[model samples]
Target: MDIDKIRNSAGSMKIADLKEGDQITGMVTVGEDLYMIANNSVHQIKLADSIDPKRIDPTVPNLQQKIFGKGSDSILVSRTMIFAHEICKGDVFEDSFNKEKIMNISIDLLRCVIDMDECFNIIKLYNKDAMSSVDDRRSVDLSMKLPSLGEKAINGETFFRKLSMSYLLILRTFWAAHNKEVDKIFDRTLDFVSKNYRDDERFIKFIQQLVEFSRMFKDWRNLIEHPKRGEYFKIIDYTYAGNNKISRPMFEVVSKKYPQEPVDLEVNMEKLIDLTISNYESLLCFLCERKLKEIAGYTFKVMEIPLKMRRYPHVRYGIALPTTKGPAPLG
Candidate 1:
């Protein structure tokens, strides 16, 4: 799939003009009632019945899985956003913001993009083919809980899961850029980011959200990578809903030393995804400004685009151009 095209379409906020409302909704019929559920993340649902394996073709779920999760994998990684986490944990980015860090971050960024692109390619095919009827759509949604991803869906899921775990690699990659130690010590990294970019409000807020998210999914890195721990927390039923209002109580293990009653807390997956994109875009734009300042030998600010670009010729297509003299249709 085309990475640029997909990335451009991925961001819900960025693509506001392209589409108006949410594309997909997550829900299941329970005793003749439809209850909405979160788009992504593990959920705890009360199961009523069991399925007989011999009744249906297994391959059906495999094909359906793709359609349900058409653009979910578009939650592609942004180096700067993930790097913001590194900053919160330590003064790493600012301290050794060198060529090595830059190169490694660039590689990680490309990997995320490519990982998402692969998934989206499969998802894109599913969307184009499966949008004909309600039964088709129902199949797409139901297959979200299929035990096996099958061959076609497996590759996409593998890459998507890799992106989830890559946040750790992202931190480690930054650490390895300057340090020799291979030990995955998270505290030091957290320490570095907290110290360095403290003054930057946006940076602090961005990292705090991620830090909180990590707290919720504390063992996510290990859980996803280790085959045995893959189902450490059972996913009762998860529907790959679109960029809708998705929030679920993620089970957070409270330390026995300080046991708390509000152990179960909710997380907004949609907000987290939005923050990830925001952090990435914000940091990326900031870096762009820095680079421009360095190369131009003067402060060259990237001001807002012209009003005309936002209004007439840019947004409206196939219109006659207004030359220096007057509006005219060119041959």
Candidate 2:
């Protein structure tokens, strides 16, 4: 019997083929009364004296027991056996393992990126050391003191201008971290602006606005990292500057431009924490993808050491299981 044919036919044999008296060379089906021959033949196999006795010493652990044992040695040995069995069965273990590892890494990277982005945003809105901080604080403070809608409107415009700067900074930082060709892109953008719109006041104004926004975002990030004592309160005040000026059109414009509403100091702080977590998750996804790509290129290196080398059954089985179990059942 050809070994390859027997291996391929192991799963498709009949119970009659596995009875006592038949000669077989392939794997025995556990709990199934079936026997497969090396040449893909089905036959009943007798229990001959030549067959090794299925003896078990109480002290000597079985494969399952050894794999789940307290000692690492036993566990490792069991894992190796399982892995070898899986390979013999034609399982694509290496590819599957690498795919999972890469996914995890990419998720982590994305989370980090998002965290950094939100951190920069929060700092820009509140921190005094951020670019446009002086103008933002002045506008907010002035708006708070005014009773008329018109005065508040004027203040809101200034505040919105400041908020736009924060958005610019966020975009800049995100590009810096993720875009390898950002420098070239920036150079091209500047050249395009100079050649086509340099003489246009609106175009120049747009460029200036974008620059300020980016600067504000970056400055805010710096202040958060190196904060001084009254800094937090000051930042909060600036963020909620037009809270009471809801009737003013300028305030509406600011709200539209930077939709982040500051809650009570404590509540707003919690929101920041939530934003941080959200950002972290986003960055993790990016990182996980990046890592997966890297892993894909080094698949052989990552899975080079065969599971058999470690001799651990649990390791092999665990690797076969899904990384995360599905959601729990509802009551």
Highest-scoring model, TM-score: 1
Question: What lDDT tens digits, residue by residue, belong to model 2 across residues 1-331?
Answer: 4433333343432333233444333332322222232222323333221132332222221111111111212222222222222222222232323332222222233233333334444433433233222232455564333222323223222332333332433233333233323444334444544675555666445545444444444444433345444332122233334444322111111122233333433233335334433332332223222223222333211122234543332433221212234221111
> Which candidate number maximizes lDDT?
1
For candidate 1, write residues 1-331 as lDDT tens digits.
Answer: 4433332343322112112334433333323222222232111232211122332332221111121122221334222322222222212123433434443453455455455456545544543443321132345564322122235444333433544544544444434444434453466655665787666667556555544443434454344345242243222222233653222222222332222232211122323334444444444434433333232232233233233542211111111234554333211
Candidate 2 wrong stretches, greater than 4 Å = 1-256, 259-262, 290-331
Q: List lDDT for all candidates, in order.
A: 0.36, 0.31
Off by over 4 Å in 1: 1-96, 127-149, 169-185, 212-218, 225-278, 284-331
RMSD values, in order shown: 20.0, 23.6
| Consecutive 10-residue window with the lowest summed lDDT within model 1 | 60-69
Assess candidate 2 and give its TM-score to the true structure: 0.22
In angstroms, the error of model 2 at 103 is: 17
